[model samples]
Target: MAERVNRLNDLTPREWIRFQKSWFIHNPPPREPGVLVHPGKFPEGLAREFIEFFTKRGQSVLDPMAGTGSALVAAVRSGRQALGIELNPDFARLAEQRVQAERLALGDQAPQARVHVADARQLDQLELPPVDYCLTSPPYWDMLRQPGFETQRQRREDGLPTTYSDDPRDLANIADYARFLDELVAIYVKLHACLRPGAYLTVVVKNVKKGKRMYPLAWDLGRRLGETYLLKDERLWLQDNVRLAPYGMFNAWVSNTHHHYCLNFRRE
Candidate 1:
């Protein structure tokens, strides 16, 4: 008989059961001023959790929309090879610097981390090995351009960009929502070719709110990508640390959305 293979998460049965819960909380650590410049930055700790759950040590991980290198840093710290692609040169440089710093702190034994200054739409053209897993967070459709967001106003006051980048190619800059979603989905479809069979892909995203209209970005992507890959399940990442604001209060009900959907998919 063939030798039984070991295919399991790097967690005990009890620990794995805990992670299987539908929802969990993750209040990110306070970001330094330098890293805080990015408008939308996920936590490295959160990325590490997903990386460790999906990939084994020394496996390759890819983040096509690597913002500030959070996923890459998590991969390196987890002793996995990582590659990141970013469209903005400044953010790509910052990601590279952060990855280098992480490598230095991790000593010479850690696996490699590389950040490429390129568009995620052109992922197929890049020379990358078949990745064991992919984790990324795409832009939430042009909502940053709306003036009603107080956080965006505050960022503008602080001399930081309210949107991701000025590049016309940036999906976040696309005004039409349908066009943006189509393009973004196309990019993911292109990336599908680079994943090893049975590898998992995780997309951390939230629905968008624009002028009292809710766009179901997460649900939309889930349905769209389901056509190509097996839609595994969704894990909620809740944030209780954000202060509550009375949005549309006394006029209409608007809950402060403090969670993101971690959409999981498997390459069949």
Candidate 2:
């Protein structure tokens, strides 16, 4: 009899089964001072686990909204090629520098990671290599500019970026909620051409709260992008380390939301 082949990833049965759990608590370490300029960034540690699970070594990974190259660095560290598209020039430059530093530390045999300073909507024109996986996250529909500027007050005082950018092209700057959802979905729809068949894309996001209104950003992305890619299961990424805030105090019911939706999809 022939032996079974694992077509998806190079993980062992034990490791694969472990990842099958729907929820995980991953509290990442503090960020380096250089990358702190960007207001939001998913940890490289979190990105690596997903990248390793979805792809084999040497396969290529793409991060459309690559903030400071977290996903790119993770890809390189996991022995895979990395491609990042960052709209902000300052963040893009920093991402490239981080990637280069990672490569130098890993030596010549390490996989290469590249950061392109351009709008992700035009990724098709970039002529990037076929990607085996994508790991990214979108802004929570201009929540940075919402009523609670308090979330960003510290970053502002420290002279860091309060939001993604002042560029009107940035999705985080789009004021209308419906338009924001459409624009976000459009980027993924265009991404279908660049992916190989059976490629997996993981979007790390959360719902947004504007005063009393709730914007289901994660659910909206899953539903809209389902038209372009196969909608797969999602994992809950729970963070337990952050200090809880009194969102509603005594007036209303509001819990300190500490979980993000790691929505998974496949390009079939």
Candidate 3:
């Protein structure tokens, strides 16, 4: 009998099966001060889970909007090459600092990680190598700038930044929803050039609400970006540890959204 071939990743059968479940609860641990300086970033642990499941060791992983290099650090931790593109030079420098620290802790066994200071929209100009997997999260359509936004409110009181940057080109600063979606899709489309054929890309995002209107950013991306990359499926990242917020408790039905859509796409 021949040994079974696992083309996607190095996961054992049991681990692979477990990752197939469509929803999971992962409450991120407290952020270290170095990374906490960034306004928004997914946990490195979560990124590693996706990286380990999507590609084997020594493969390359990229995060186009690498806020503080969460995905890059996760790649090195999982024995993969890491590449990242950060728009803000300040954040880019910070990401490099964190990556270097992580690599030093692991010593020579750690894979190489590089963070490029550039906008993701200029992906094609960056001359990046084709990658095996890409995992990233775009800003949630300027939700941080919305007055009285729950998350930003807390961030403000803590003296931390409530928004990504003041750069006019930053997607998080775009005030118009339609324009923001178009530009975001364009950036992802450009990502196609950096992804090897059959590579998978996972986008972690959620819908946003402005007063009574809810914008389906996740669903919209699934449809629009599907034109450039195959819309494979979706997994929900549930956060159960969050303290519930009383939003519109007395007047209307407003849910304390604690789940994020981890939309998976593949380059055919």
Q: Pick the candidate with the highest lDDT.
A: 3
Q: Model 3, which residues run further than 4 Å from truth?
A: none
Off by over 4 Å in 2: 147-149
TM-score, per-candidate, Cα-based: 0.96, 0.97, 0.98
The lDDT values for all models are 0.90, 0.91, 0.92
lDDT of 1 by residue, 53-171 (tens): 89888898999999899999999999999899999898999999999998999896978889999989889889888999999999888877888887898888889878888899999
Candidate 2 similarity to native, TM-score: 0.97
How do these models rank on lDDT, best leading?
3, 2, 1
- What digit string (tens of lDDT, one per residue) describes model 3 on residues 1-268? 9999999899999999999999999999999887667878899899999999999999999999999999998998889999999898988998898888888989989888899988888889988988999999999999988897877778888899888899998999999999999999999999997899999999999998887989999999999989999999999999999998888888899898999999999999
Q: What is the alpha-carbon lDDT of model 3 when measured against the actual structure? A: 0.92
lDDT against true structure, model 1: 0.90
Q: In candidate 2, which residue pairs get closer than 3 Å at backbone N, Cα or C atoms, i.e. clash?
A: none
Which of the predicted structures, 2 or 3, would earn the higher lDDT when compared with the native?
3
> Which residue window of length 10 is worst by lDDT in model 3?
32-41
